[model samples]
Target chain A: MSTPFLKKDKTGICLKLHTALYGHDAIEQFRGAYGDGLTFVRRGAYWILSFADALEEDVVDSLDSLLVLSRNRKK
Target chain B: MKKFIKADGWVKVPVQTKAYPLQAIYSAGYVFMDKAYLYLDLEAKDKVVVWLKPKAKADLDKLAMEFCQELLNYAHYFSSLKVNAESTKLLLQRALFSAAPSMVKEAEEKEIQDLIKELEQEEEKENRKPVKKGKK
Candidate 1:
């Protein structure tokens, strides 16, 4: 389930989320939940969550939940 | 012995999941925190690819070997803990039992008395110090 924001590169697949929409805390939460399979890096105002090839599907599912949680917290 | 591929300034080490689980990889990475920047990737199903980049001017080969050794150490530690889990649980229960409210109160009372005695001894030692006579 790849979204427009999620794409595959030479290294692996990455999901890019805006820091404004998710905030910095989301990175830590995602990393804690996914462990080594998930690596996060901040590029300008966006946080990119890169997942290993083997973990692409799991990362996508986790990302969906993270976005849902972020939306709920906003309300 | 596991083989690691060296390229440029980074070492790509492959770890078998059956021998060293993800936890062991994490532990090994933590142990090498000061020496190198460790990255773990599960590109394959049963293997973890560990990329170790030296943080300082050091021997990459030696660091890679040390990282492998650390993984084995953690694997052994984890396996031993699993084997002794029941004994550990029992020990913890006994420890908690021994640390009941009554036992804690008694220990606190003893500690307070010891602290008071030490303070009094310090005061006495200060009192016995020779006083400097002020010039008239």
Candidate 2:
């Protein structure tokens, strides 16, 4: 049998499954299957992110703008 | 029966490279998505192919993420200069095994074990089949 997905090396950013807004339940279900590594949160509209560390301050700010731009484009 | 000669059929070619490291990030992402939905081709080399047959949602998702990273990495690496086909191939293999080395290794190990188990099960089943009786 294949070895279950376990934390390999606790170094780099932990793999996170990010999804669109409507994908919350799907992300949550995945969290249940994979463990607590998954997180649901809001970005521009909404996003699911998992990472070893929060992005750099500038990156966060840029992402925020990008999210807003994306939201605007949708409408 | 009549003897006949057969000719080889045409087949789509596959490309094997990590990603070109000089394209727009968003456009690169789209290329990855397209390839995932279709096939990965090596346009430089007789178009050799490489792809993963996702067995589960998790597997598919992970592969998508890896593709994203490869595109990002490729763009980052080559934005300043031109990359040859040889270097491109190496970069892609690195991307493949680098994204989730542990996961890929685990999967390969599991696949080997599963194959062994399957062979054993087939052997057991063969031993259990009833033999046909000849006419009395």
Candidate 3:
């Protein structure tokens, strides 16, 4: 599935995932998975995922899995 | 050769892409994050222009030198990491071995013994060095 909020730039792609409420916990998870290629920046109430160009597919897949799991857990 | 030009208060340093890749340049830029505001531009297919604007009142020449130094430091850092990648992986694996609960006790014991033996040998080599006597 495509990430609707994902935006492309010269450096890489960015996803608007609002995980700021969870603090650094959620950020740490993505960092552990993506290593140095990915960074998370807090913009207002939302967290933005800035990822490298090479790992665009991996980032999208991981985000999809994360979203699905989170939804399943909630149910 | 690296080229440097001073324009106003900003120093523009030209770095070859072959000598230092974008990743290394970016790493060096990150190191100067608190000290200067950095702007990177592609001068050519093989050249990158780094514009450094000092945050405080500092010598432009010195800032240029420091930026070049930072670039070399990052270049060496990345090259060394590439060289030691295999050894680093081995070190990490050894470190994580103890965390694996399913690992065999006998194998862990042997690994510990081998590490102790290596440490003992290193200590012995250190002790074998002659002490220098001070002149009276």
Candidate 4:
């Protein structure tokens, strides 16, 4: 079965990111950049970013870099 | 700590915060950012589940082992940072503190120059003022 963090359904694959870890600002920045290709929704503590197709490694790395940048700035 | 499980496409590593703090986990993940696609989940209050998918097709066992080593590297690095934090801060401050007097001196010299210029301008103005001629 698909996990809460990663899901695959009829629509496509969606990744849920926790705001507490990555923070809201970074997620918003990621959304701003990827909003055209992705759908971002807030269910609760997590922001679920959905993609129509399976995400490539670069896309995932982009998010990872954003989160790390945010975390580093906060520190 | 040696436990590394290989799933269909991802390698799952369950880390305990007691052994590997969250900060260390983030640090470790950062180092592996170029190597893998990472997904983090909360397994428990103190346990973090790290899911890794290698960017290239490679040995899962070796990849998992490297990740664990990366975790240990960061864990020690962070703890050492904590231990040296005060001294590091003080050393940095001391270095800046030593350099500050020269900066302060430069500012003081500029201020003195400005004051001298103001005084000279005032003197010039005083000299330029027409003196009232007294009846001889």
Worst ten-residue run, lDDT, model 3 chain B? B36-45
lDDT score, candidate 4, position A43: 81
**Ranking of all predicted structures according to TM-score, beginning with the best and ending with the worst:** 4, 1, 3, 2
**lDDT score for candidate 2 against the true structure:** 0.41
As for TM-score, the candidate ahead, 3 or 4, is 4
lDDT of 4: 0.76
Model 1's alpha-carbon lDDT is 0.69
Weakest lDDT window of 10 consecutive positions for candidate 2 chain B = B2-11
lDDT for each of the candidates?
0.69, 0.41, 0.66, 0.76
Estimate how well candidate 2 is docked, as a DockQ score: 0.02
CAPRI docking class of candidate 3: incorrect
Ranking by lDDT: 4, 1, 3, 2
Q: Go through the candidates in order and give the C-alpha RMSD of each one to the true structure.
A: 20.0, 22.5, 19.6, 10.7
Give the TM-score between model 1's chain B and the true chain B.
0.68
TM-scores for all candidates: the values are: 0.50, 0.20, 0.47, 0.70
Query: CA shift at B92, candidate 2, in angstroms?
Result: 10
iRMSD for each candidate structure, in the order shown: 13.2, 14.9, 16.6, 3.2
Considering only chain A, what is the TM-score of each predicted structure?
0.74, 0.32, 0.64, 0.69
Candidate 1 wrong stretches, greater than 4 Å: A1-75, B1-3, B101-136
Worst 10 residues of 4 chain B by lDDT: B1-10
Model 3 gets an lDDT of 0.66
Classify candidate 2 by CAPRI docking class.
Answer: incorrect
* Candidate 2 wrongly placed segments (more than 4 Å): A1-75, B1-96
User: Which pairs clash (backbone N, Cα, C closer than 3 Å) in model 3?
Assistant: none
Over the stretch B58-105, how does candidate 3's per-residue lDDT look in tens digits? 877788889889899989988999999999998887777667745557
Q: Name the weakest run of 10 consecutive residues (lDDT summed) in model 2 chain A.
A: A1-10
